[model samples]
Target chain A: MIEVAGLTKRFGPTLAVSDVSFEVQKGEVLGFLGPNGAGKTTTMRVITGYLSPSEGRVRVAGYDVVEEPLEAKRRTGYLPEAPPVYPDMTVVEYLAFVARIKGVPRREIQTRIEEVSEKCAVTDVTDRQIGKLSKGYRQRVGLAQALIHNPEVLILDEPTAGLDPKQIIETRELIRGLAGQHTIVLSTHILPEVSKTCERVLVINQGKIVASGTPQELTHRLQGYETVLLTAEGPAAEMMERLQRVSGVNLVEPRDAADSRVTFEVHAEKGHDVRAELARAIVESRWKLLELKTSGLSLEDIFLQLTTKDLGEGPDTSDKSSVVGIV
Target chain B: MRNVIAVAGKELRAYFHSPIAYLVMTVYAALLGFFFYSFTATYVVQSFRIQAMGGGMGAPPMSLNEYIIRPLLAGVLTVVILLLVPLITMRLYAEEKRSGTIELLLTSPLTDLEVILGKFLGAMALYAVLVAMTFLYVGYLFLHGNPNAKPLLAQVLGLLLYGAALLALGMWFSTFTKNQIVAGVVAFAVFLLLFVMDWVTAYGSGRASDVISYLSLTKHFDNFAKGVIDLSDVVFYVSVVVLGIFLTARSVDALKGRA
Candidate 1:
């Protein structure tokens, strides 16, 4: 229900968001994964009609955000990085004000407030002033404000930034429950949040969309070769040599050895599964197999690799060619 | 219109929820009351002195409107409003920008005009309340003295318009910065300049001198103080009010681009 095309936002001479384009379909939960200062908030602000794009255009629910801002804004709900709340007002009072501005009918405002308060789990603090609430409650209140209008599109910038672990889980569950009814575009620096709650992920860095895919696809696409970790109580030098002889085994690197126990990272050719062959080879060699597991690239490693490549810093061991395909 | 009211209602609530509304009202009432007492005492003393002269000399008649209500509304209240209006209008946009609530208003479906007008009206409402307190003192005059109700009404109208023009200008200054203190200081400085702008006419006489005196905020109120509602005075205050609101709308619009 949202489309951003060639959206470039410039603050003075510095570009906050540059030539970025993405689409989120109806009822689809898209995770905007980026480290801090990755233009995630800037892009969301453009989509929500808070900040006009310096170049290009953004449309929400078929209304151009720049040309028909009121219509676009009517259908979009935004929760900025800092919750846009009046600290002096009570939670209920704040929600009621948001409901009014969002154009909820007078009679329906009460019901809508109660519904969102319950959904965001902020029902208990309804009567208390927002300034007195805990950070977690305030964040939830922000979430409730965004959901008050029940808009078709929800743009949340760092929705789970300040919540405790339990509160974070509850918020994720709440967002997951909102999937089919509302199109959500939530930005976060937390990698696991994307894998747990989002159907698709857009990884952004330095005002650019670095990568976009499902959690599994991102991992698989970035890792061009299969890798296996085998730990055995044997001589480290001999085990590395034996594993290197297995068919399809492209390379083997020893990781750690202590008290005659050894760890080896075995690399296999693409599309090859060398686990069975390596296991059989270890058994025939009379070495006791302690642990054997295939190790695919996790999202964390992929994120670090993707974000660190541009900085020309961090570990650069991965083949650069494999990453160029996804971008 | 509904959106405007909603924003204005929120602005009003913000003012009341904080200590600003009560503090300003109490301080303004105290100052105005003190001025009223001193002005009334002086008027009473002057009347007695004029009567003691036995109406023989060519001394002018001591009218209550001329001696008390005119200066109270036109001079004392104008200065009082000058001192207090920045307190009311400084927080209109500055606090919203400071606390990040501007995002909520800007991203909402409401137009920039609606938000600006709502804040304008909200500040005007509080100013009205401050002006309304003078009625408590003014009402007392009717019971004891034969003050001209026509001049009193005219002066009150003039005070509201005068305060409205300043409030609008203060609100416009508030849109420039996120710091309320800075907004208040700048607004007060500009108001002081406008208040004293006519003073420059004493030094020279030319087209520039006439323009400066005409632009002086207090000069236009002189007509209303004399019980005459000059159309030119009305138009001047209205123009300033409109200009202030228009500039505020543009500032808020530019904020979106820079935000």
Candidate 2:
């Protein structure tokens, strides 16, 4: 229900978003995965009609964001990075105000507020001033305001940020519950939030889309060939040569050798699993097989490889670097 | 229209919930009350002295409208509103910008004109309430003495237009920055400049001075205070109000780009 084409936003000297293009279909949940300053929020702002694109155009529900902003905005709900709330207003008052501006019918306003507050789990604090609530509740109130109008398109930026682990899980479940009803484009740095909640993922870096696919598709695409680690008691050079000759094996390199025991990393061609054949050959050749396991790339590795590898640097190999810190 | 009312209603509620409105009202009531009592006391003393002298030197008696009500409403209240209006309008948009609520408002379906007009109307409503409080003194004068209601009504209309123009100007400045202190100070400075435009023209009466006097905010109120509602003066106040609202709308639109 949303189409953003050639959107470029220039803030004086820095280009916050440049030539970005993407489309989100109706009832599809698209996860926007990017590190901080990856133009995720900028793109969201453009789509929500908060910021006009310096170039190109955005259309929401078939209405141009710049030309027909009111119509476009009427059909879209946006939760900015910071929940835009008045500290002095109570939860119910704030939601009612949002509903009013969102063009929710007056007669249905009360029911709509109740429904969203229930959905977002903010009903308990309806009478309390928003400033008095905890961060989790305040964030839920923010979500409640966004959903108050029941807009067809929902754009949320970092919906789970700053929440406790339990709150994060609850929010993820809430967003998942919204699937197939509202077209959603949620930007987040958390990896599992995407894997657990999104149907498709778009990885953006440095104001450009680096990768776009399903979670499984991204992992499989990044794993161009299957890798198997084999530990055996054999001469390193001969074993490496014999392992390469095995069917479906593309490359065999000796990883380490100590006395008679050596380990070889076998890379099988894409779409091939030659573990059974390689194990039989190793046994038939009279080499003592100590360990053999298939190693497939995880989404974390794929995300790192796609975002950071293109910077002319291999993935950082430190213990802390193994975690997905960027996206 | 509903969008405008929605925004305006929220803003009006915000003003009432905060202590600033009450604080301004108290200070205004005390100052205006003191001015009214003192001006009437001075008028009464002069009247008694004239009666004691048996209408000495053929001096005509001073009308309460000329000597007391006109100065109280036009002179003293103008200054009171000058000091209080910035306080009323400083947070209209600046608070939204500081707290990041501008995002929600801008992203909503409301147009820039609707948002600006809503804020304008909200600020006007508060100013109206504050100005309305002074009418109690007017009501007392009507009950105790013979006072012409025509000029009184004219002055009330004049003050409404005058105060609205100032409120709109203050609202426009509030939209230019996220700092309320800056907005208030700059709005006061601009209001002060416009307030003194007539005085500045006193030094000379050239074409430039004539233009300055014509542009003076206080200049147009003089005719209304005298119970003469000239269309030009009405048009002038309306023009300023329109100018202020238009600039504020443009500023709100500008905020989206800066966002």
Candidate 3:
């Protein structure tokens, strides 16, 4: 339902969105994952017809954003990062206004407002001024406004931002409930939100698509080195040295152990499970085996590796360097 | 037309609820009262002398209700409009961008022209309502003085035309900057230039002087103040308003692309 081709946006010497292209089929939730300045919001704005692209075109539901903006917008609903709201207006009034602008039929406006408010779980605060609502409720109101018209395409930018853990789960459930009914392209800096709510992932970096695949596909593609943790009652350094000397054991580092017990993190080469070897060696050495477990990397590690831009063997530490203090 | 009315209705209602609008209305009513009372005092004191000398101030050929009061009103109200219109219209688009509401409005199916026109109409409607509430002064003048009614009617029409032009200029000025304070100062600066164009022209030589004078807003406004009601003056103000709206629409479109 959405197709973007060679979309480029430039402001003087700064290129906000480069030559990026992607497609989102109907009834699919595509997660756009990136760091702070990854141009995901810029691309979404171009598709929503809020910003014009310097080159190329974006089409939604078979209509060009620039050439047929009204029609394209008619089929699309957008929730910007801030959730544009008026302090004085009640939730219902705000949603009604949005419906009016979206050209919802006058007779059906109230029903549409009710439906969206219920779907977004904002029905309780429908009569209260939006300015008086909590952040979570305010976000739900924003989502309600976007879903009021029942558009086929929804583009939400950071929908779960600033919400509590419970609110985030509720929002994810709401989005999941919307699956197969609309094509959604959601952008977020939070990798876990994508892992939980989206089926497909599009990773963008510095105005370019660095990777795109399902969560499992990406994890499996990058799942070459297997990690295992071994806990034993033995000399920590000696056990680490022994494990490191093993043929399939790529690296071994000693971790903390209490009560004369030693813990080591062992990384095995591809297509090898060094767990059995470590267990047999520990039995032969009369070392007591405490615990053995496989260590799996999270989407966080995958994100860090894909976006670190440099091929390296050490644990990625760049996530801390990208912190921008709120001034 | 539906979009225009929907957007305009919401904006017009917002003006009523905003503190700035009420503050401006209070100040305006006070200024009107001050000027009206001051004009009455001056008329009574000055006309007394003329009447004693057989000039027949009482029951004279023209009453205080005549068109002479229009100029003083034109001057006072023009200054008042110069201050208030910028405040009312500056938030039309600038505040939207600052508050991120512009994104919501722009992402909708409405065209740039629709947003500009809706805001323009809304601002003008609120201004007109403010102007309309001044009808108490009309009733007061009519009851107290047997003024000639023709010129009063002409002057009212002239005020509407001149006021429309100024509102449009103010709306256009608001679109250029994100800061309302900057929008206000810039709008007043723009008005000041047009307000003082005649002075700048006076010091110059040749037809440039005449051209500047003709282009001055005050110059066209004066015809309305004097109850002249010339078509050229009316057309000139209307053209100014149209030009301002056109520029505003173009700027909105340009901003969406560049900003």
What lDDT score goes with residue A90 in model 1? 99
lDDT of 2 by residue, B1-259 (tens): 9988988999999988889879989999999999999999998999999989788568766788888899999989989888999999999999999998999999999888898989889888989998899888878887878878899888999999999999989999999899999999999999989998899788997899999999999999999888888899999999999999988988887777874
Docking class of 3: medium
B1-259 per-residue lDDT for model 1 (tens digits): 9989998898888889999999999988898889889989998887788788787278756788887788888889898889899999999999999999999999999999999999999999988999999989888888898788998888989999999999999999999999999999999999999999999899989999999999999999999999899999999999999999999999998987994
The C-alpha stretches of model 2 lying farther than 4 A from their native spots are: A225-295, A316-327, B52-61
The DockQ scores of all candidates, in the order shown, are 0.70, 0.57, 0.70
In model 1, what lDDT does residue A82 have?
92
Q: Poorest 10 consecutive residues of model 3 chain A by lDDT? A: A318-327
Q: List chain A TM-scores, every candidate, in order.
A: 0.93, 0.86, 0.90
lDDT of 1 by residue, A113-197 (tens): 9999999889888999999999889988998999899999999888888789998998899899999999999999999999999
Q: State the lDDT of candidate 2 residue by residue for A1-327, as single tens digits.
A: 999889899888899988888889999999999889989999999999988899988999999999999999999989988899999999999999999989999999999999999999998899999999999999999999888889899999999999999999999999999989999999998888888989999898788887787888777656667889999987677777778889999778787889999988888887898998888888888888899999877777676766675575644332223323323
lDDT of each model, Cα atoms only? Answer: 0.90, 0.88, 0.82
Judged by DockQ cut-offs, is candidate 2 incorrect, acceptable, medium or high? Answer: medium
lDDT for B192 (candidate 2): 89
Scored against the true structure, residue A27 in model 1 reaches a CA lDDT of: 99
Please give the range of 10 consecutive residues that has the lowest summed lDDT in model 2 chain B.
B55-64
User: In the order shown, what is each candidate's alpha-carbon RMSD?
Assistant: 2.3, 4.8, 4.1
